[model samples]
Target: MSKLLVNEKEIVVPGETLATGMDNLPGNGTYRDGENIIASRLGLVQLEGRAIKLIPLAGRYIPKTGDTIICKVIDVSINGWRLDTNSPYSAMMSLKDATFDFIARGADLTQYYDLGDYAVGKIINVTSQKLVDVTMKGPGLRKLKGGRVVEVASNKVPRIIGKAGSMVSMIKDATGCNITVGQNGLVWIEGTPENEFLAIQTIRKIENESHLSGLTDKIKAYLEKAKKK
Candidate 1:
């Protein structure tokens, strides 16, 4: 039948040989070089011992029950505020959804959350219609300011932040840029524009090559080279 190829992570290279052939193929990430296939992402690998290929045990994002996320305030109405969830679906934060305190009538609520403000919010509810409701009444939830926001694919966010904030902390240490990564793929970088730019570029590089192994060391070397340049 077919053979499998070994790679550090699952990747879509330019070709498939007879030893790597599959009669019917799955989408991206799953590849066959004959019957021997490999995983493309950093997660548990699932294999089907035939013409099929490997599947990642984990997916990038599937809205869950209690995911804390960082989001931007886009618009506000008498009823609630609109939030950019960084995905195709947007989120809502009703005035009533926030704190339990009584709000003044016709008060400048924008003072609480102006457009372009970022906040660490939580998913209070997700409807069957994909309507997401969020709240900022929890710990570590507040507005963001004076930073540059960047968008990346949802799948790359984990790589940018790394395990337990290790990757982001390292980048901040190297570039002297403060970073806040949102679960929905929104990143805020604050510092001198030069440092911010460098940090963003570095994070992007990490994201693009995250499927490869030993990425932490590679990123360290890249920062060093960039500094030398």
Candidate 2:
């Protein structure tokens, strides 16, 4: 006899009578009243077969046990390459983990990945202390080249990426740019001079106006105007 309503993607609220039944649950911005559930943020709605649930759109970038990310090789040693994960904590890529074979101890490890080389890889593990271990033995996870890196607020990343990459894809498709979003809020965009500028503008808009509701619609409108211009 209990009733639950889904207002947005990140939370679920109960109706008037149901609130009394759901008093124990925490508030995640999605709340319920007698009439309907209210959405606290903009996100995709998830239907749980028999129920409605909301998944938050914004969150901190906690390096998980198997998250794939783009990183920069900053240092090298007999052990491996030191990486900057866009977080306070850095990670290591053992030489054995670099690639197959015969890598001389130190004939200039830079030859292998050099300082400032960008690589996409997976987080093999993370210690409770936040020590991150990463590897590159996967598809489409390797060094990146010829692009400029930009950072956006971590909380705004989902809006910037959109559902199923539709938002990002539109920017890429219209501007003719190649872009990649790192979970750490780092975005890489490379393309013709004109396209790069357009992509940058789009991402900046997403960051600045993240608080506004109906962002997807706004973005579509913006892109349409741009197309006409």
Candidate 3:
């Protein structure tokens, strides 16, 4: 017989039994312990058919190929720009990958991106040595201006994005801020100062209470209350 010991979206601690019997398959954030499936980390339980996974409550970012992320330009070199990827490893974007225009040697690269500039980029590849290469030549990828960037636990990104972006969409509708969530956990918000602060508060709230069920509704209520203040 198969049994679930915890409810979906419940916060579970390490070694807690999630499910039992062969019909229940363990997924990310979970492991099998004898006949029982156990939580491997503190996270929220997610059920999909007979398979179960957990969304981690918190963790640092790990760079991966094809992930869209927000990066800050740290330095510009002769061939490329070094960016702070919000990971231990920095990423480089060559001039060729930055734009379609052929930039001449000795052309002022700062004209395109200078130190302290933020950009939306995609990880093109990650080497065995942990070298990360990124690109900016794609739809909706560009330099970010006149906004503040905030970060959450990288593992919590999926929850912030929600199922098919429902959560982010809700934040946008409630706050009226143009928000961009990076896979690396960095978030950029652009709007009036008040709206930007509201968006930041909303995102931080989601990060803290992500493991709770009815999180979307909770955030909605929080945002509504902010409107009265």
Candidate 4:
């Protein structure tokens, strides 16, 4: 018979036994160890149809191609802009990738993206050397204005997003905030001062309590209270 060694949604540490027996399979964040499934990192346990996985509690963002991310403009160059991608490696958005508009060779580059600007962009490529090339030509990729940004554990981004985007949608509805969640953990919140704080608090709560069950209801209830206040 299949035996569960831990409760669903339980927070587990590295090397903790998650289950026993051969009836279950190890998925992400877990590994099989002599008839038992063990956690490979500190994360929340997720059990699904004989498959066990983990949602990591803390980790940095590893740049991946095709990931939509928030970036900060750090420097401008004759050819492109250097961006801080919240990762160990920096990213570049070449003039061709910056926009469709024709930019003369001698044109001022800062006119396109000034220093200290925030933008929503997509990762077009990541080289073996960990060099990241990003683009702003796609839809919804542009300089973000008038919003505050916050960072969270990058690996926890999936949890903050929740299933089918239910978690983020709930937060938006609750605080009436325009929130853009980057897969890299840079979140932009634009709304009234009151709503921005509410969104920030709610996101931090999710980041802290992601391993708990019934988190959707908890966030919803918290937002309801914030609305009433």
What is the TM-score of candidate 1?
0.71
Q: State the lDDT of candidate 4 residue by residue for 1-229, as single tens digits.
A: 6698998888899989899999999999999989999999988888888899897777778899999999999999888999999998889999999989999879988888999999999999999999999999898888999989999888878878999899999998888899999999999999999899989999999999976889999988888887888
Q: Evaluate model 3: give its lDDT.
A: 0.91
**lDDT of every predicted structure (CA atoms):** 0.72, 0.72, 0.91, 0.91
For each candidate in turn, the TM-score is 0.71, 0.72, 0.81, 0.81
How close is each model in CA RMSD to the real structure?
A: 6.4, 5.8, 3.2, 3.3
Candidate 3 has its poorest 10 consecutive residues by lDDT at 53-62
lDDT of 3 by residue, 113-172 (tens): 999999999999999998999999899899999889998889878879998999999989
Residues 1-229 of candidate 2 have per-residue lDDT tens digits of: 3444333343333222212234224244345554444455544456454344455565556676776777898887667899988777888887767766577745667777888998777889899999888887777677788978888876677778888988899888888888888777788889988778878998999899976888888887887788688
Instruction: Give the winner by TM-score: 1 or 4.
Output: 4
Indicate which candidate wins on TM-score.
Answer: 4
Judge candidate 4 against the unseen true structure and give its global Cα lDDT, from 0 to 1.
0.91
* Candidate 1: stretches off by over 4 Å: 1-44, 47-62, 99-102
List runs of model 3 lying over 4 Å from the truth.
1-54
TM-score of 2: 0.72
